[model samples]
Target: MTFENPAREEIKKILERADNVAVVGLSDNPERTSYMVAQAMQARGYRIIPVNPNADEILGEKSYPTLKDIPESIDIVNVFRRSEHTPPIAQEAVEAGAKVLWLQLGIANEEAAQIAESGGLTVIMDRCIKVEDAITGPLKK
Candidate 1:
């Protein structure tokens, strides 16, 4: 079966209620797309938890080596990793009890989507969270 993302209104609601975002593969460098997107989301009031194994910190937030390393609850697990690498992350997000599994633009993995969905996560694939927030966020300025 073809993978279809949730409708726009549903995505809006997800952004509205979300408070914490665990950004997997978020980069320390400001030039990276992951860094820029997470920074914008942070400015919009969502707590940004950087999940980067190689970085000590990103955007002033302490970086965790994995989703399981995060101590608090996660509203969204936003991923910047390649499609081939997402299935394991999906499992981790499930283990971490995240509400949503969001794969960033240009990345989508069927196995990952299935895993997250089976684990009760609302999955959004191949969409830019930053753009979605700007378009549909109630907290947008």
Candidate 2:
């Protein structure tokens, strides 16, 4: 059976509980979607850890080459990578002990979803975390 993502109730809870978000495939370029999303989330209070091979920093946070390289606890693994590149990141997110594996818009990898699910991670696929946060923000008011 194809992996199904979590419902809105669970998604809201994940956002409410998560304090740190590790952005995989994050880009330093201001024009990039990853950068924009990460920047917005960072501005909204969630700590953004830049996980990119080339950059040493993004949005004032130190960058790491891989998920396994992050020394601190990760509340979420937010991926901007292609579907094909996501399965390994999913595995590494589990190894790194992240609570959630979140895929950006238009990205969906069944294998990665399965891996994350088996690793006990709450997986959100083909959806923008920033968008979800925006949708749920009004409820807090």
On TM-score, the candidate that comes out on top is: 1
Model 1 regions more than 4 Å off:
none
Which 10 residues in a row give candidate 2 its minimum summed lDDT? Answer: 132-141
Q: Give the alpha carbon lDDT tens digit for every residue of 1-141 in model 2.
A: 777878898898889888889999999999999999999998888999999989998999999999999999999999999999999999999999999999999999999999999999989999999999988764221
lDDT per residue as tens, model 1, 23-81 = 99999999999999999999999999999999998999999999999999999999999
> In terms of lDDT, which candidate is strongest?
1
Count of clashes, each model: 0, 0
For each candidate, what is the lDDT? 0.96, 0.93
* RMSD of each predicted structure: 1.1, 1.7
User: Which 10-residue span in candidate 1 carries the lowest summed lDDT?
Assistant: 132-141
